[model samples]
Target: MRILICHNRYRQRGGENLIVDSEKAMLSERGVEVIEYVRDNNEIDGYGLVKKAMLYFTTTWSKEAEREIRELCRKYKPDVAHFHNTLPLISPSAYYACKEERVTIVQTLHNYRFLCPGALLLREGGICEECIEGDFRPALRHRCYRASYIQTRAVVRMLKKHRQMGTYEKMIDLYIALTEFVRTKFIEGGIPPEKIVVKPNFLRNPPDPKYGGDYAVYVGRLSPEKGVDVLLNAWKKIKRFQLKVVGDGPQRAQLESMRVENVEFVGAVPQEDVYSFILGARFVLFPSVWYETFGTVMIEAFACGKPVVASNLGSMAEIVKDKETGFLFTAGDPDDLAARVKLLIDDPTLAIELGRNARAEFDAKYTAEKSYERLMGIYASVIREKETV
Candidate 1:
């Protein structure tokens, strides 16, 4: 089968970008013909002020992107097209182009851009779902995007324009939500439940399961939304258990100033090195405050047979079975987080048992083989439905 995957690459690469590459590699290994049409956000940097000013309008509908997709579809004649992220660059206009070329559209809900303009249901250091009520004006009023009213206004305009044009409702054939938590949220935001499917991100090249190590590890962005400060505060109370943080972000300076004991800020290691840290950890810590779309590191930790102590919210709560595969604590609560850490450290037997369960879960649900099967079924179903219609 021929499948065309489209993505808008971010300026600062993250886990999502890595997932895109992994997915493409998996498809190619399965002998499927994969056609890519990727756009980069770096293009925005080269834009003049006048064009930047017009970005708000064009972000809603990009004729240039649409035309490019149309040309690619005509040439490749793929059975289906998949989209990852399409914000200001690719836009939802590409979906229209897919329809024009008789291509089945499959979009992955990587983040919460559809429900909230800031793309993370976060505002003023807390969860804010005002936009989920189907109104984005609050995002503008608070300047949620970049703390600038003008930028927030631009995002609001794009969101309003797309909802009016029925781009999400009419143009896209299927939506791949990364978790049940995310799927339910999308349904709440007015997406048809029938049009959405739950598929967690898979672990690529997972290591052999081996539990019990010297320290606990945290792997992700060190921003406020990630609850880094909460983590540092929690670590201050976590007695003997050493914490190693393996990421760098806007809050690095803030984190360094805290002087938390038994915490090592090993900023931004290579992906392979990050995996090594997971393999050598007693457990992984994911203290994100936002309703995470999915936990890429959680699955990786599971693959390495390491238990996770995650915030009891969103995908983290849903993914980590409390006291089964891992433990969960109250979101943004440092005291609760500290207690959970104590639970894992105090009982090495329990932690190892949890790690073993995590490995088993990864084998059952998150292997690349399983992901490939799920994707193939979704593609086939979409094609069959298209033929029937």
Candidate 2:
């Protein structure tokens, strides 16, 4: 089978970029032909003033992307076009190109960009779904995108234009939501219930499970949405073991200023080193306040057989089974987070049991082989349905 994988790479690489690369590699390893058409956001830096202004219109509908995608479809005769991201670069115009080519379209809901201008459904350090109600006015009024009304307006225009054009509802044959929570949110935002499928990100090369370690770890960006401040507060309450933060972000300076005791800010580490940190942790902490599309680190922790202490909201709540694979604390509540951490610290054997359960969970759902089977099944179903139509 042949697939056309399209992605608009972010300026600062993240988990979504990694997932796209991994999936492409996964398909290639299975002897499938994978044609990639990737564009990077970094290209915007070279744009002139006139071109920068034109970006607003192009972001809504990129004629260049459409023509290129159409040419690729004609050349490759791909069975399906799987899109990972299309904002500010590729644009939703590529979907129209796929529709015109009569190819099955599969879009992965990497983030909430389709439903919210901020693309996080987050505002002011909390979950905000005002835009999900089919009104972009709230986002514009608050300047949710980059805290600039003009930038927010551009994003709102793109979302509104595509939403009205029936691009999401009609052009795309299937939507790949990273989690059940994400699937439900898209359904609520008016995508057909039958069109969306749940597929979590998988770890292609998971390390062997480790039972116990010296410290607990947190392995994501240190931004406000990640609830890193809440984590520091939570750590302050626990004096038994050390806390190691293994990533860096916008809030690094402020977070370091707090100087919370027993917490080590290891900054951003290499991917392999990050896994090594998880393997050496008794448990992992995920205190994200926003509704994450999918917490890749949660699965990474599970793969290492280290239970997580995550916020009890959104994908974190759904992925980590409280008292089973890991424990869930009240979202944005430092006390609750501290208490959950204390549970594992007070009972090392309980942590071991939970970690073992986490490893089992990863084996059952988050492995690369399992993800391939699910993806292939989805592709086959979509292709058959399109052929019948």
Candidate 3:
């Protein structure tokens, strides 16, 4: 089987980029031909003001991307064209290129970009669905993207144009959602229920399970949406265990200023260091305030035989069964988060039991072998459906 995978890489390396690379490698290892057409956001850094302005306007329909993709499709005659991120570089016009060439198109709904201009479905430190079923004016009014009205307007225009042209409704053959919670949200936004499928991200090589450690760890961006502030407040209440933050973001300086006792900010580290931190933790912390599309950290912790103490919201709630694989605290509530952590700290044996259960969960659902089987099934089903039509 041959697949054409296209993605617009973020300026900074992120989980989406990692997933795309991993999936491509996985398919190649399985004897499948995978061709990638990738664009990097770093290219924008070289543009002048006028060029940047032109780029924003053209984001609604990137003719250059369409031309390149059309050429590639004609040359390769791929069975499927799978897209991850498009945004300001490879626009929705690329979908039309695939459709015109008679290639099956599949899109992974990594975020709520199709439904909300902000793409995160979050505003002012809370969940905001003002534009999910409505129009994009609310997003324009709020300047949801980058806190700039012009940038937000550009994204809104792109979404509006695609909606009117039926690019999302008709061009795409299938939508891969990372979790059932995410799939449901896309359905609510406008996608047909039958066209969407749930496929969680997998660990290609999970580390061996370990039993016990001293500190608790948090392993994602230290941003407002991640609830890092809440984690700090929660840490203030706990005296028995130390907390180690494993990532960095815009909020790091402010977070460090608070100087919460017993909390160590281990800024951004290598992937190997991240695994080391997780392996040396009694439990992982994920106190996100927004509805995450999928909590990759939870599965990583489970793979390391460490249970998580996550916010009881969206995909986190769905993935981490409270009192089973890990414990869930009320979203954005520092006291509740502290209480949950206290439970594991007060009873080390309970933490061990939960870690064992967490590892069992990973073996059952999150390994590379299981993901490849499911991925192949999705691809084959889409190909067969295309043939019938």
Candidate 4:
């Protein structure tokens, strides 16, 4: 089948970007014709004041993107249009183009942008559902986006405009939620339950299960929302085990300044290296403060036959089964995290059992083959429904 993929990349590279790239590659590898239309958030940096102000209304609903997508639909006649991200660029306008062209539209909800202005559903280092519960004024008051009132107001306006226009309700055909927890939130925020499907991200080259494991690892962006500080603090309290951190972001300087003897920062490594690190690690630490739509790192750890010690809230709790495949700790609590990590460290036999179950879980649900099959089913179902209408 011919597919057209669209994404608006973040200023800094992230999981969404990686997922988009991986999906495209997987499709091509499977002999499906794939076309890509991409835009970057970096474009906003070069815009003038007037242009920036005008973006609030049109940013998430661009006529130019609509026109371009319409032309692509006519030229390529793709069977499905799979969109990863379209925030601050590409916009919800592309969905209208697909709707007009009678093309199947499949959108992957990588974050909570449609329901919350901050996208993370986070504020003051915790989960905040003000926008989901009501209007986005609380986001404006708190300066949620980039901690800038103007930027936050702009995002809020964009969300409010699309919502009023019924863009999400009318334009989107299928919503590919990363987890059941995220699907619940989207439904609570007014998205139709029947239209939403759960499809977690899959790794292209996952690690093979090993007999023994080495150090405990943390691999993700080093940001306040990721709870890197909590991971570091937790490691400081526990002296028996070693913790290796991968990836770098805004919190690097702060993480570097603190002297922790047991923790070592390896910085950001390539995708292959990350998988290798996961294979070598005894367990992966995922101490996120926000309500993550899906913890890709946790899945990666599972794919590598390594169990995870993740936050008890959000998708992490759903993904990592406590005492089964892995363990869960209270979000933002260093003491809880340390205790769980110590449990795994102290019990090698239990860790081995968890690792074995983790690999089995990955084989059953989190493989690229499984993802492709599920995606094809969703596309076919959407297409058939649209044809009937």
Candidate 5:
């Protein structure tokens, strides 16, 4: 099958970018023809004042992107058009181009942008779904996006425009949600349930399971939303259990300041080194405060035969089965997180069992082979439905 993958690259590369690249490579490895048409958010930096002002309206419907995609479709005539991110770059207009060409459209819901202006159901270091539940005016009032009223207004306008245009309802065929929890939120936000499918991100090349090792691990951006503060506070309360935090972000200075006896900040490491850390760790920490659409790091830890202690809300609850594969503590609660850490440290046998189960879970549900099979099934279904229509 020939596929045309579309994406708008974020300023800082993230899980979504990795997934897109991995999926394309997977398809190619399986002997399927794949082509990518990508745009970068960095382009916005060079725009004039007038163009910057126009970005708010164009964010949801880019005529330039639509025309460009239409031209690509005319030349490539791909069997399916799979999209990752189309935020302030490609825009929702690309979907209309696919519709106009009668092509199968498959969109991956990498984040909650469609439902929340901030794209993370977060405000003031906690989970906030005010925009998803009701009026987005709260987001406007709080200046959620970049903490700028103008930026927030732009995001709100984009969301409102696409919503009114029926872009999501009419243009897209299939929506690939990374987790059941995320899928439910999309449904609650008015997306058709039948059209949404759960497909978790898979590792391109997973690390070998580490049977036993020392130190606890934390991987991902060291930002407040990631619950680094909670993790640090919990570590301070605990007497034992060495915690090694990987990855660098805005919260580095703050994290460095609160370094306890057993807590160590290793800063940003390469992706391979991250997997190595996971393989060497007894457990991985995912104490995120905000609503994570999906926690890719948890799965990575699982792939390395490491159990996780994640937040007890959002996708983390769905991913980590408490006392089974891993444990879940109340989000942003330092005492609860510390208690859970103590539980894991106190029971070595239980921790080993949970780690074993986690690796098994990864083999069963999150392997590259499984992901490819599921993706192919979705692609076939979308194509058949489009043909029938």
Candidate 6:
């Protein structure tokens, strides 16, 4: 199959970027022909004030992206055009380009951007779904995006425009939601249920499971949404379990300043190193306050025979069966988080059982072989449906 994958790269490498790269590689390794039309956010870094001001319009629809994509579609004549991130660079115009060429368009709903201006369903360090179901006023009122009214307004306008244009409804052939929780949210947010498919992220290449460790580990960005502060507070209450944080973000300075005891902040780490950290831990923690779509790291832990202690919210709650594969704590509750960790710490046998279960779960649901099957199945369905059209 000849596939055209387009993505607007983030300034800093984020999970979506990593997933896109992994997916492309996976397809290539399977002997599929993949063509890329990508743009980078770094292109805006050197732009002057006036040029930057023009970005407001492009975020909604980019004529340049449309032209470029149209040219590529004509040249490549790809069977399917799959898109990942298109935020400020590639824009929604890529959809129009694909539509013009009769190329099937499949988009992964990476976040809540289609339903919320903030893209995270997060505002002021908490969950906020004010813009879901086609109402963006609350987002504008709260200036929920990047804490800037202008930026929020810009995103809100893009959302409102494409929403009205039937871009979500008519242009795209399929929408790939990372989890069932995410798929349900999109359905609730007015996306058609039949068009949305649930496909969780998988480990492209995984390391062997390593068990038996005294320290607990956290693998994710140290940001407010990640609930790093909650983890720290929980750690303060119970210094019995040594904590190692593996990732960095804007909140690093604030978290480092807290002087939380028995914790080592390893800063940002590479993918392989993250697996090693998880392998060496007693259990992994994901204390996210917001409804995480699906955490890639959680699966990584499962693949490494490590039990995860995740927030009892969204995909985490569903993915990590409480006391089965991993434990789930009350979201943002430090005391509850501490208690869950204590449960595992007090009973190493239970932790080992959960770790074994988690590894089994990874093999059954998240291995590269299973992922490729589901991915190809989704693509085949889209292609078959497209042929009928």
CA lDDT of each candidate? 0.91, 0.93, 0.92, 0.88, 0.89, 0.90
TM-score of every candidate relative to the true structure: 0.98, 0.99, 0.99, 0.96, 0.97, 0.98
Q: Which stretches of candidate 3 lie over 4 Å from their true place?
A: none
Q: Please report how far candidate 1 places residue 187 from its true position, in Å.
A: 0.8
Off by over 4 Å in 1: none
Per-candidate RMSD vs. true structure?
A: 1.1, 0.8, 0.8, 1.6, 1.4, 1.0
Location of the lowest summed lDDT over 10 successive residues in candidate 6: 206-215
Instruction: List, residue by residue over 24-88, the lDDT tens digit for candidate 3.
Output: 99899999999889999999999898988898777998899999999999999999999999988
Question: What pairs collide in candidate 4?
Answer: none
In model 3, residue pairs whose N, Cα or C atoms come closer than 3 Å (at least 3 residues apart or on different chains), thus clashing, are: none
Question: 1-389, model 4: which lDDT tens digit per residue?
Answer: 88999999998777889888988998899998998889998998998999878787777568988999999999999989999888778888898898788788899999998888889999888888989954998998999888988778778877887889988888888899999999999999999999899988898878678734768999999999999999888988887778889999998999989878778899999877888778888998999999999978998888878888999999999999999999999999999998999888888888889999999999999899998898778888888998898
**Of 1 and 5, the candidate ranking higher by TM-score:** 1
Per-residue alpha-carbon lDDT of model 6 for 76-183, expressed as tens digits?
Answer: 999999998898988998999999999999999888889988788888877887778988999889988888899888888888999899999999999999899999
Which number leads on lDDT? 2
lDDT of 2 by residue, 1-389 (tens): 99999999998778999999999999999999999999999999999999999988999999999999999999999999999999889999999998898889999999999889999999998789998967999999999998999889999999998888888899999999999999999999999999999999999999999987789999998888999999998888997699999999999999999988888889888888988999999999999999999989999999999999999999988899999999999999999999999989988999999999999999999999999999999999999998888
What's the candidate order when arranged by decreasing lDDT? 2, 3, 1, 6, 5, 4
lDDT of residue 185 for candidate 4: 97
User: Per-residue CA lDDT of candidate 1, range 1-389, in tens?
Assistant: 99999999998789789999999999999899999999898998899999888887778788889999999999999999999998878888899999999999999999999999998999877998999967998898898888889888877888888898888889899999999999999999999999999888997699898888879999999888999899889988985778999999999999999998888999998888988988889999999999999979999999999999999999999899999999999999999999999988988888899999999999999999999999999999989998999
Off by over 4 Å in 5: 48-50
Candidate 6 displacement at residue 50 in angstroms:
2.1
- lDDT-better candidate, 4 vs 6: 6
lDDT of 1 at 72: 94
- Please give the lDDT score at residue 324 for candidate 6: 91
After superposition, which runs of candidate 6 have C-alpha atoms over 4 Å from their true positions? none
Evaluated against the true structure, the overall lDDT of model 2 is: 0.93
